[model samples]
Target: MRIVIALGGNAMLQRGQPLEAAIQRENIRKAAEVIARVAKDHEVILTHGNGPQVGLLALQNAAYDKVSPYPLDVLGAETAGMIGYMMEQELYNQMPGAQIATMVTQTLVDNNDPAFQDPTKFVGPVYGKEEAEALAAEKNWSIKADGEYFRRVVPSPLPKSIIEVEMVKKLSEMGALVICSGGGGVPVRKLEDGKLEGVEAVVDKDLTAALLAEQMGADALVIMTDVAAVCVNFGQPDQKKIHKASVQGIGELDFPAGSMGPKIDSCAQFVEKGGRFAAIGSLYDVEKIVTGEAGTWITNEVEGISFYEKKEEAAVA
Candidate 1:
């Protein structure tokens, strides 16, 4: 089966860890192992998030007093290339003689998207409340509380189309393990003159991955992340893992917009558009996720065992 796997940012680097090249590469190596395993059986296309990476670049650029900070578009491209390079190299080491290609993809977004007005995407490292407030004031940045620490937020527009999807599909069909759409394809917009221009916004990677799956006619989308499964009332006593669910059932649980919500919504969108299945689970368990042994599976069909139902059955027995 042809599969598209979207790697979450947290999967690439843990929160609060120092931004170091060696550390990030080690993390990529681990992720690459799992990806290489899946690629052995299926034609695989990879996409990944770069929120923390891009934001760190922006912060570094701000320190240069002679020139203005680079726009998000340029930073986004840099991240795609940087992250793609590491991922490609590591995957190659794991699966020697396999054809792997990393394309710097472009994703088109609406210039007038409401997301521009409300920047809610978090980026960069976390900071103490006081430090976050100070930076927000100095940089004119939008700040939001992320768990125990605060981070910067930016507009996250929805991706309308993958600009280089045709070529990506061609590569995938030819048996190449392709990686594209880093940081949601660099977030571009169409101009009145029929030219594409970069925009100052972030695009959600998970949504773009779903779009890629739909366009490529992939059988399933596997979202590899830090968590093992999608849960209801996460972090509470009543929290229940959702082993399998229909699109409508996943919607009833309120996932945080900054985190799991996009993954759930993306899976639902894929299934709604006639894709066979979507799974979200720990990156370490990619095999199980693909085989439906682990993780949260979302489908249009409502018949199947759910985690909650299994718990009830065990209780009765």
Candidate 2:
């Protein structure tokens, strides 16, 4: 099977944890064990989130006065390389014979996207109200309250196209386990002359992963997140996990924009665009999830067993 896997940021870095190289490397090693098993049977293409890493870079810049601060797009690319190196090294150790490659992917976005005018996507470290106001004044950063803490905000534009789609597809066909389109692919815009220019925005990683899956004709798009399944009323007492759902059915559920919302949308979009299936689950259980033992599978049909269910049923029958 050909699969495109999108790894979540928090899955790599936990809440209130120190941002240390050792911690990140260990996390990748754990994730790679799961990925290595999948690569044994599937043509795997990996993508990952860079929210925490890029935010760390931003914070580092804030602390240093001598160095020039990098833009979000550039920072996204940097994290892609940094994380990709870690993933490559770990995956190589775990899956010795597999050929792994990382691409600095570029995703196209419209120049006039409304998100450009109104930056609402949060990035970087959380802060108190007083600290937020102080940083806003000193660095001219846009700050927004996230639950109880404040965070830096940036534009989150829609992903229109994947510039390296053909290259990615070709590499996959050649039996290469590829990692590309990290952090929604360094959001860029194409000029009239056909030159691509980087923008000061972040593209939703789920959306970009879906696009990559579609473009590469992937059999499945497995979104590895912190949660095992899509839940209704997330974090509330009434919260319930959905084991299987259709594209339309997921749309009916209430999901927050900054959380489980985009993931559901990405799965729905993939299925709607003629893709086979999309799975959402925890990174730790990726092998089990892919083998039909865990995760929520979203598909177009609702009458029969889900993809995972059908696989298990077939195996038993």
Top model by TM-score, which number?
1
| Candidate 2 C-alpha RMSD relative to the actual structure | 3.9
Per-residue lDDT value at 290 in model 1: 89
Q: Against the true structure, whose lDDT is highest? A: 1
lDDT for model 1 comes to 0.89
lDDT of 2 by residue, 1-317 (tens): 89999998765776556789899898889889988888988899999988778888988867887977777889899999999999998999998877899999999999999998888777776788999999899888888887788888888999999999999988888989999999899999999998989998888889999999999888899999877666666678775556667887777767777677788899989989988889888887787667656787788766323333434433322
CA lDDT of each prediction against the hidden true structure: 0.89, 0.84
List TM-score per model, in order: 0.95, 0.91
Which runs of model 1 end up more than 4 angstroms from their true locations? 308-317
Each prediction's Cα RMSD? Answer: 2.8, 3.9
In candidate 1, what are the lDDT values of residues 253-289, reduced to their tens digit?
Answer: 7788878988989999999998999999888878888
Judged by lDDT against the true structure, how good is candidate 2? 0.84
